[model samples]
Target: MRQNHHDGTKRWARWEGASLPTNVRPPILADGRHSSGLAGCKGGGHGDPKAAFAKAPTFSPDTDFRARVAAEKFHLCRTTREKGRMGPSKSSNTAPSTLQVHRTSDLRRLLADRPTWGRLACGVPFRDPRWLAPWWDSFSESAEAYALVASDERCVIRGVLPLYRRSNHGYRDLNFVGDGAACSDYVSIACRPQDSTAVAQAMAAYLMDVRDDPDHGWDGVEIDGIAESDETMRSFAQALLVGGAAVHAHSRQSTWLSARRATWEDHLRSMAKTTRRKVRRFGEQIDGAGGLTKRVAETENQVDAFLDELIDLHQRRWRAEGVAGSYHDSRMVTFIHSVAQAFFLSQRLYLPTLWKGDRMVSAELHMIGDDRRLYCYSSGYDIDSSHLQPGRVLLSDTLRELYRRDWTGIDFLRGDEIYKRRMAATPQRIVCLRVFSPSAAGRIRFETWSAGFNAKQWLRRRLGIPPLSVVGMCETGTPSR
Candidate 1:
């Protein structure tokens, strides 16, 4: 068996600051979905250099028992700053002290002492027990999973960064990001308000130490998909830079419409004349189609039927075009079913469907959290029913309802489409970065070749590529967008 890094004696030695020298292994050129290079490492490129960095997450004691322990053992203090804003406070406060790093295994001990990990920031209540089981399961079992927990002796709660160790199949290169790729957003360090810096320090300490240690295998941590407004993202970026690691700032776009308007017309009027006309026309058609109705499934039990219908409609559309669908594979179906069920139970699922009388023609699965309504997956009629423009109507009506629910905006997720443009929702970029070490030079070379291999997949758009997906030759089944 691979050496257990968690043995008590070795663990104790690590706790007292023991270092294990690990050699950087050559990057492997694996053949699989990850290396096919179909998926572009797109999204944000580098951003401005002079922005003020957000302070790192620390620990707390009064309300944050974890902070108390860090205070005793690491002389850690809680600190806070707005996301993206950089430079020390101009008000003459002393410059923030340098943050430190901790190891991945050592994080759990900190968690044992604290009451819990960081608070779930989004509206979905991320820290709930329901999320823990599945989150941990994915982390432990997935080919890629890396986590760091921070806590004090006083409480089991402190902070945690649940990251994944990802490898691109085409490149055979490794990188890290939050656990769920297509399902989650707004990931950052979860901790008490006071422990921001400590959390940042711990993250830096852990990453730097891992890079320097030959035993711990990692090129570097590329914390992906962090909201531009997250303090942890800022702090982590600074900490990485200080540790002699390369840092890049990239921009991501999320489309949102302000819902605090006096009237729906007020919202509608904000759109360009062309978009407003399309939306208005679409709604009229839906209303004419035997009265379109909308429903929200309140319980997990209700989701299966909805998902079943969605899959049916989606499959029908693709098959009609002589293409494949996700439902064709039991594994894809099972994965979607599992994720949907888990999301619903956690009250994280926000699937809305529109039906004409008894016939369901359109559906959109969304996640309601972080005060943002995320457009996760959607499907609708392909029959070209002029009256029931199923897809268009569903989205239009959904927006009106979302406005009522006080959601700030809709992250239409990734990809580009005509419907997205009509909604006046702008596109945001999500860029992926690959950092290879001297040991993994082989992997880096493979990735460069794989990127080219994958780029050739665009030719098959007439066949069955996903809507605007980065296509690769190694990719088989169609992607259910």
Candidate 2:
């Protein structure tokens, strides 16, 4: 018989031919130590308590001791599990590696991970660093970049949430990077489809852990223009809910045109008869009057010229209505120029000008997605050409060109404008989600703001004013008329 102590547990064994028996249990001494069942044992048989166990007849102390101990431990573990005890089982499967969340503020760090970011961005043009970096350079004077990155044990990036932090009414506010005048649509967490939930849960836990930190904590977070079809963002929102966040979501509609038809004629045939006749008539009127021509910006100089014309026309049209257009601000113009150049270099910018003989009728700025869809971001049209419906003619011609190039669709991002419906664009839902941190200050601030917002909405309803537009109102944390 032999005995050993391993890992603070007294293990008893009866060795025979250098192997421990699976069911061996030697005699126990009064001091809670196992003893060799022999008459002259050096350790526990009588006086010396610290003495080692005496050698058995067939046991060699130096022969395969570790192997024997390991085998015994494995046997015990298996036996314990079989007897319905709580212990680790001997199996090949392993637990998943934990995800690590890192906070970064440096633009170069994001740029360094540009390839990974682009892959995880999954073809959304707004999520591209090329677009976001320029937006940050132009408009981030007051805000600080606070991006969250998730990675696995192997240091492979799994997700990235590009956000900017700012102070809002004595509370810290976090918003998506391209949220304001950039008007980015379909913004979401950049991650692979399979890792979305795991990454979200990890990020939510990290947010909870930091919610009370003096410098890094956030009181509120607002994410806008999340596509309703994005399961990843929905999972992320659900994770935040599980973390006890006060999540409020508002839904709005965006219009889209299916441009996958084989030809422009086929596309027009798919529309309603009345709409088809109107679209055809608009195109014919422009072509027959003088001559219709389309100019697409292919050089940097051309891009700058087109942008200038677009800004002038847009401001003139809106000025005629006694309002400043979207491009009135010089900062916005600068941001547009910078981002437009970046997109143009990436071969994603689409600036098309429609002309009627010698007069420019309309101009549009579009960005192409990796999925071969055109995002109709902004447009400017001559109010003088309203009678000829220059905007519609331009859209029709643009679709014709896109179809010839085998593009998939066109997105009339955000807004329920009558023109979108008139052009036979179908409405799709997008959500703006606001999540308040689970901290005391966050709760109070959210409640107070909610009450005031409710009252304002009620007053608007009573006074016959339209409810706040989510697209225009969410950017600045205030309603924009």
Candidate 3:
């Protein structure tokens, strides 16, 4: 049997001798008219059954017609079941709640719907408006709020794509608000899982619609740190591709430690024998060095002091390597301070300083997700206390405590540092998705940027250096214009 789909695709099913379900409509014939005969049977023919069957639509006895028909029905049922699970489909013309785009230039306007936004953020601390608002407060001097929000006909928010527009080298581009020096991971459209595809399609359509508007149009878009497995972002890219936009993607790996063990000892035992030994030795060394203690900033009043110490230590460590650290930028410092305060108020900040008696040995900036997972955002350690191995010792202690407390997991965030691997954190892939509008100007910009990026990659390979990363480039300096 042949069937036509609304999307202009055709599906063919082979039929063996089987009765069709009463509710199953008759198949459409090759002439695009419904056949009055029962499926798999000859119409009104009173001849020999074999002769009549020969003239019917060809069927293979090997094919299970009933099973195929059942499967098709199931697919239709599933699609219908999910159709309004996350509001109406954006592509449907008769959708009861058509998705609408609400563009805002003020972050405060977006925050007015904080409760809904937070729900849509779905427990990713970095994507929370609480985090992005602070980031924008500190970095807004260089960018304009261009957040795209999607709502249903009833004004109920379905998704949010937190972005800011910036002009670079005479071209305007849009980027995620919590990006740049913050180095946010798992960044993507904020929406419920069921609504992701519809939300993404709506957002993509909004972008395409505004591509030519003088005030709202953008030359390109660059979204980094989205997880490689994020179907929402993949759907968004696919939608843009279907709209003739040029999209580029790059993938990188992040490390995560499973922390679901019942006890700290059990967690240690699960690690490789060598790793277990190293963790023990590191703890012993730190203990021998005047015994280590962790001091967490339990209140907002302590946020600034803890953050200042982290910055000082981080800059010192990086300067020793002859490179300015991420905190070296004044804007970045301000951004971090603001983010720390906001996250602290939200009970997601996990700033801790490791001390050896009177000396601060290491500090880590972490964020707690709604799932109780810890995201190790950034860290700083006293290079002067290398013998004590402050970083490793602190990490070991942190993991032990989190495991004992029944935390879901601990992410090492981005980068593939040897220490993270030695600690037995598994790798997860993240990707950067870039799209150029389908306009002439967008095409020119994409070609120019692509050529330069390719040249950089070629040079890095020739020099035996690792591939370039958007995060690395942002940390080192402003992204290539």
> What's every prediction's RMSD, in angstroms?
14.6, 22.0, 16.4
Order the candidate numbers by lDDT, best to worst: 3, 2, 1
Best by TM-score: 3
> Which residue pairs does candidate 2 place in steric collision?
none
Off-target runs (Cα >4 Å) in candidate 3 are 1-97, 252-258, 284-289, 466-481
Ten-residue region with minimum lDDT total, candidate 3 = 472-481
Quote the lDDT for 45 in model 2.
14
TM-score of each: 0.61, 0.74, 0.75
- lDDT (Cα, tens digit) per residue for candidate 1, span 1-481: 0000021123211222333211132111110011111122121112211232222233211122222222322211112122322222222332222222223433223333322432533343233233433444344343443455443332132456655454544322233332343233445576543445445545554555555343455653444444444544555554444444433333333323234346778768877898898788766755575587777777776688888888777777777767675466554465556667866876677887777778787877665555555545545464544356677777777767766776666666544455666576665444332233323543354355344434544444456743222211111111111
Clashes of each: 56, 0, 0
> Which candidate do you rate higher for lDDT, 1 or 3?
3
Q: Flag regions of model 2 displaced more than 4 Å.
A: 1-97, 252-255, 285-289, 464-481
Write down the TM-score for model 3. 0.75
In what order do the candidates fall by TM-score, top score first? 3, 2, 1
Model 2: per-residue Cα lDDT over 99-163, one tens digit each: 55655666445655567877788887888887788788778988977777665544466788888
| Candidate 3 structure lDDT | 0.65
